[model samples]
Target: MKTKIFGHRGSAGTHPENTMISFKEAARVGADGIELDIQMTKDGVIVVIHDETVKRTTNGKDKGWVKDYTLKQLKKMDASYKFKDQYGICEIPTLEEVFDWAKSNQLLINVEFKTGLVAYKGIEEKTLKMINDYGLEDRIVLSSFNHYSLVKCRQLSSTIDLAILYMEGLYEPWDYAKRLHTNGIHPYHQTINKEIVDESIRNGIAVRPFTINDEKKMKEFIDYGCSAIITDHPKMAAALIK
Candidate 1:
């Protein structure tokens, strides 16, 4: 089980998360794939920002970013504007834009579904449609902690691979993925160990851990037979691992 470099939120260590610029840098570093989170906006538009309340990720003018506003409103807020003095003002991009860039650049993408309490209103359907629309069944990996979202995706897209993202101390999760017909398991960085990873591998399930930036930690993931390792610094990890 050789580990490949999966960029977390598109080289977020270098730039803001879920942006075209960040993803481009990640591709420049030769990441095997880039990971991003998705949340739908008020007008039922599926955008690529992570938080349910967009206050943290975007520089919004009013109450919340995505909860009350549509993609048009989201476009006005500069997600990286606050960091302009530091990293410069970069605006938030939609999922369509992200996928377009990734597909054109021949990059693999891991899109995480985050629906907040409201469940992003048909994001799974939209995502499945996008996968088909972009003809990215082979290049994109759809993942989510929400089993319902993943299940919907599996039902919707026959070819687009699905990964069930879980955190530490999860009990008997493989049974769930099997039921959902998922292709892989994506776990948090700290919780994965040699035993679980090997078990997953033995079952013919692909195992990938998320957001691992530590070189030694990544070495351990490789030692555990993880299929892939998602990282904030794919450039650094790719350099060190080679």
Candidate 2:
């Protein structure tokens, strides 16, 4: 099969990361999928954003933590102000909004739980329930650097595809994934090599590397036969694959 291109934070190279504008642009530019981060707001709402702090993506001056604000408060912040003006005003979208948008499309959604930094209680249950409610169980893949959270997710649903994300080398990531009963492994792009990709393929586990932006590097991973690549430049990657 051809390698798949998943927009990392939804065409983040040219748009506000994790905002609806970026997601739409990724689809418009022919990305096979989109990778986004999720965290729970103070009101227990699942919000789509990458960082624990809203300062980086939003126009908030004090650098508010997502956990410290309610969904209403978060929605009020302008998430696209830092980006080029063409992106227009963007708000932090609730996970439900994303699901509603995704239901009509064929794009794969890689939802990374932002639990490695802040472990929101009941986030796993909430996420699983929401995914099921949206009827996106098959089209969504849950990933996190927190392996325990992934195990908790499996405890709730056996069929939800899960992937373990790590930034460092692993002895045998496929084996670890097997133990976790996950279907895939997400390694940092720089950590992947031909041997790792081959082993993952042989083991029937998907190998997806993250944040790949360079054209040459994207082609290298494709040549290594990666199952998918999460990149800030999904349009560029899609063009290269063609």
Candidate 3:
């Protein structure tokens, strides 16, 4: 099968990571999927963002922890602070807003739960319910660094796809994934090679490496027949694949 390309944080190299404009740019560039991180707000609303703190990506006056702000408070901050001169202000988008936008397109959504740092109680259930409500289970892939959270997600829903996110090399990670009831693995780009990809595929596990921005590495992994690659430059990957 031809390898797929997923936009990392929605073309993060060009647009502000995790913002709606970034996601739209990914789709416009013909990306097959878009990967994003989600963190819960103080009121239990799921919002798209990478950092646990707003200081890194936003122009909020407080620049506090994400969990400490309500959705309304969070929206007032400019998520595109880095690109403010170019894109003006961009509000942090809610998962629901993204879902509503995604419904109009065919892009697959890989939602990474940011629970490894702060365990947002009921985040799994809330996200799952929203996916189901939007009838997007088939297009959504839930992944996390927290294996326990992945297990909880498995207990909640057996059909939706789950992938383990790891930065280190693990022995026979496919087997480990099987034990966790997950079907896919998202490893750091440097942690995998041809042998591991072959082994994982042999065991019915899909391997998709992350944050591969270099042209050489992108071509190498695609040639290796990886299930997918997450990259900050989807346009470049798409051109190479074609």
For each candidate, what TM-score against the reference? 0.93, 0.97, 0.99
Please give the RMSD of candidate 1 to the true structure. Answer: 1.7
Candidate 1 lDDT over residue span 36-144, tens digit each: 9888878877788877777787778664746578778888878773346677778778888887776677778899988536656777888888878988888888898
For each of the candidates, give the backbone clash count: 0, 0, 0
Model 3 residue 21 CA deviation (Å) reads 0.4
Best by lDDT: 3
Query: Any residue pairs clashing in model 3, and if so which?
Result: none
lDDT of 3: 0.94
**Residues 159-226, candidate 3, lDDT per residue (tens digit)?**
98999999998989999999999989999989989999999999999999998999999999998999
